[model samples]
Target chain A: MAAEIKAPAYRQFSIAPAIQPGSMADTKTFVANEKIQEAIGFPPALVDDWHDRAIAKMGELLSKYRSFKVYMDACVHCGACSDKCHYFIGTADPKNMPVARQDLMRSVYRRYFTIPGKLFPKLVGARDLTREVLDEWYNYFHQCSECRRCSVFCPYGIDTAEITMAAREILNSIGYGQKYSNEIIGKVHKIGNNLGLPGPALTDTLEGLEEDVKEATGIDVRFPIDVKGAEVLLITPSADFFAEPHIDSLIGYAKVFHAAGISWTLSSKASEAGNFGMFIGNYQQLREIAMRVREAALDLGVKRVVVGECGHAWRVAYSFWNTLTGVGSGAADPYAMQLQKQLDHRYKQPMHICEVTWDLIERKVIRLDKEANDKHIITYHDSCNVARGSGMGDVFGGQFDIPRNIIRAAANNYVEMAEGTTREQTFCCGGGGGLLTDDLLDLRVKGALPRMEALHNVTETHGVNFMATICAICKAQFTKVLPYYGFDRRTVGGVHQLVSNAIRLGDK
Target chain B: MTMTTLFAALFYLAALLFSVGLIYRIRDYARTPAPLVIPTTPAPRTVGGVAMRMAREVFFFESLFKGNLWTWAFGWLFHVGLALVLLRHLRYFIDPVWDWVIFIQPFGIYAGLVMVAGLAGLWARRIFVDRVRFISTPSDHLMLALIIAIALSGLFMKFVSHTDVIAVKNFFIGLLHFNLQALPSDGILYAHLSMIATLMIIFPFSKLLHAPGLFFSPSRNQADNSRDKRHLSAWAAKLESGK
Candidate 1:
């Protein structure tokens, strides 16, 4: 077979491996896990003009949406945010400049959606939208990791990630969409979540996990599937089932559950909770991903649902659950009904992994031997979508301490990058939105630089070996980006790995 | 003997011309608000791309000075020198070059050379690059030409034109002190003094204000994160109403 002219690993999350005595000479070969590739069900390249219809609709929808008005109106354009962008900080490439990325989409939005833009293109400096401009929009918007680091320094708190999402939504409406995003959305619709594992695949995976746990630690760790009357339904990200670093996180959750002696089951129907719709700006898809989890709990009679460590998933689950429940008749939505039935309809239950993890720690349900998990000197990468986009500040009390506490509980030493590096001020890994796919690698790494620099700063002084994060995409991003920038998996992984290792699963 | 009265009359006339020029420029901007905004390099394509693009251009100047290292080096020196020269003139308004004043004055002259070279290169690029020349306004050329003239006159007076430095200083001190002393009677000093007065009056109304306005314009000052959220600009709202 002709060798694939492999693209360079440019962004924060795309995998690049160090040279060693190995069969393959390139880094891409080592990091490309064939199983995870199959797990995502990669789609065929998009057809031309596939997005024209969607873009028109988006032009109309965005024009009407009041929130967009608030967003565009709020920007005074102080230029304070440019240096703060991880991508611009990383590459020093002018195109990679965050403001440049936003301009590609903003000008079009102005041209089509604003009266000032339409009447006097020359006056407002707005240009007519052409096919070439659309292509530029496609290339640049996807490049945004949708990291909200820009918002931290922005005086008005204007978020470009939101604009990227809005643009993707518009693009999707026109049929101009990334196969990676659509394939994931397609999986949620056809199966239950982004990972497209059918009921059988999910059941088999859990069964296999049970065997692995029993072998690794001489304990009967049951990964019950669709078991009725369970108190909790664990909603794992598809990454947990497929992606290696995330899979390790899943094992961590399993061990934590075992040590806590909690009655939890993995529902085959809603095995995955990640919704690419969040990235693409499709609320319907976002609803579907959440609906499956809500339905799985209903179908199995579970009382609570424990979300996995996926950043956007946790964000969508928390922010949109109520809206989805209220939309189209409150009870008509099966997802809301299941939750209402499980929790006595009086109080709305919080849906997030952080909340669940914090609760578990607070309850003192599981005993942790912090020293046993001390192999890694870990630091947390707070996800922008969670920390800034969705008001995650109050959700975890003050700042990034919750994730830190979990790390501290799992290990002896916990470190931080800088004051403005995480939580509300965390730098993006540059692979958010739909930039996680292989196509927008250049833009992604360019955007990952600020966060990478922050990581470098702390890691250099503290001798911190590993970078841990709760967001699945962050893991996917940092895992790929760290190596290219001269860091490794030993330098980055999910927080779940710590929990899994620290949980006393008994002697093997 | 009555040379001080004649010099005072010339200064008033020059100041009036400067005021009229500024008013015309302000009126031009107020009329359209379009010239104030042009399709600059970092035109935002995504919703918040404008903010992000604007931010980089405004603060880091990440777009202008990045990668092209030599241009950045020259540009920085020039801007610093120009600023220092402007500040040093304040010494003329005072009785004498106070303690530590002479130290800055010489440094300013040296820095002025960097600014002159940087501006010359940029002006030259405008003529050389097809795209840049295509966008170049007559005003842009005139502004560059005038700054070069100002810097040259100042340089000539300090180094080449060896005019009566004491007499010129006394003339400036008398003007600020309101005595309006007689002109120094040196052709070079007279030309330099006239040029300095001319430049000051034109400063506020020119594109040079981009130095300050760049910090406020959304096109060059914002980050690109707003695409993740919905942004509805006031202009969009107004456009929707007409629809």
Candidate 2:
């Protein structure tokens, strides 16, 4: 009877990472390994021969820093950092211990690199670096969301996330890397976006959405796709184009635009705002993607670029965007990164989608009809990458509150998840760090159980039928996991979706 | 030569080594910079719960009280009793009499009892617990043995032997003020002094340095609210402007 319940189909399409630039050809050649690599192309790595290259690169990178030497010198394995983890605290899994989690990488790193290990070996739990160890590194290191939460509690401030990131980079250098990240990087290199669906495809998607809006409301909404003189270039997750929940967000964006009578365009060149390289410690690729998006904005003559609901996408946009371009590249200011750096002193422009949404409501440009979204009981899921990751928790807290306010304006009841899942203590959707597309479903499901459990608690108690989120990937993950955990799909939608449903479509 | 003078000479030399060594080591630490220190949650200054945090630390050992309650309980007891014993020993340094030191003697003996019990509990915990045993290096076990030995020897002089503490006090006082002194004729007291010297030399290099460090610890000392705000420390500001 249990076997009759079909193993839930893992949703791979909507949340897959952007692939690498020069990695697809290598993925094509291998036989059995190729099948595994192709099965989850989001986390693309070199097939069979990748291990040799990884080992060589590990030596070169390890030799460059005294920090790794210090890291090797430290670590008493007191296990002080184990139970402090939210996952371990929530799950009570023994292997989720931070010291134990890090031992997977540290043991291999010691065997191949350190002196005592190369000499005595057995005294320090060090072992010979082998293909098996590399396999372990691939499995375990990717499990970390690179959240930096564990480091907060560690007495030594020893960041296991930093070690995992370094390990991922070492793997990437050897051609063992994520396919989706590589693909997106390749797109950034070639067409200035991760979505590989280039300028014309983006325009077509926008134009089609325009027609959808026209049919729904009888309002002639023009989604300006790369209009040269536009004041704002609105960018968002690639998932919003075809994905169910975020499409409603796009409609909300259109309605807001119509009411404000503001000139904005979806950049034909840089349609997708997410940069997955930020997750894998490939700072160069991260910078390159940001550069292309900024270049598109500059070339098309938009004064500002507003990013959408993705978390790490906003992090890269806010944190690294300015530093990597302009003076870092010795080029003229690209507008977006420059605006962020001098938020107080720069041009009186630059805004995120959430900010713009609140501004439209504040200006009384868009009048929302209160009865449209009154049927379902909804609650907000704060994206870690959005709230804390991008250093916009306060800003997005207010912004996220605006969406819930709009929902409450439509309906009297909106709820919050458990204690630690809001404001300063929000949890990451298990699919963060391009792990959403990696072939680690068992790990992802187990890791995401906390979030699913929290959501389930809300549903059982408050009859929360609607799970409203801002990020596109959050929408995609919920759509896939909610049903497996027994929550209906009709309950999940973007913040903009609620806004679109409630806002009067035409002249009120 | 007078026996008292010999005692003073020996006492002065030991005191010189301890005071100078402690100060030198502390100075070195003060000069060294700790560049990164990430603060954790519910730090003393930041907890918003209705209960006072210090009350929790004193009563519950809130932060020190961890998932492994038995080990943590022993650790907390050991630390509290050890701190009191050290304070009681301060009587040796003062000349004439500080009324408070004499007042605290009975409390000191009680604290010693707690320390002995806590040390035994911790030693047993290290031996019996599976995960603790697995991660316990030989050095870890050896360090515990050294601490237990020191604590027990001190406890013996206090409760069992009842050695001539007057002579010991005189020796320590002469040493603190730089009068060289000979050992008290009691061999057990000499053994206690020797054990204490060994512990002092080892203290700087061992995990026992956590005693002084726990106070400076960014996790424990600083406010957690600083992370959300752009907190510019004076030193940080000076460095930035200098750059």
Once model 2 is optimally superposed onto the true structure by TM-score, how far is the C-alpha of residue A110 displaced, in angstroms? Answer: 7.5
lDDT of 1 by residue, A420-486 (tens): 5666667777777766866556555556766776777777899888888888888887777666677
Cα-based lDDT for every prediction: 0.60, 0.59
Error of 1 at A315 (Å): 0.6
DockQ (0 to 1) for model 2: 0.09
10 residues in a row with least lDDT, candidate 1 chain A:
A22-31
Tens digit of per-residue lDDT, candidate 1, span B93-115:
67656766767877777877877
TM-score for each predicted model, relative to the true structure: 0.61, 0.70
Question: TM-score for the first chain of model 2?
Answer: 0.79
True contacts kept of each: 0.00, 0.02
Tens-place lDDT per residue, model 2, A327-409, is: 11222323323433432223222356766766667667777776777787888877755554343323324534655665666
TM-score of chain B of each: 0.66, 0.75
Q: Give the RMSD in angstroms, all C-alphas superposed, for model 2.
A: 8.9
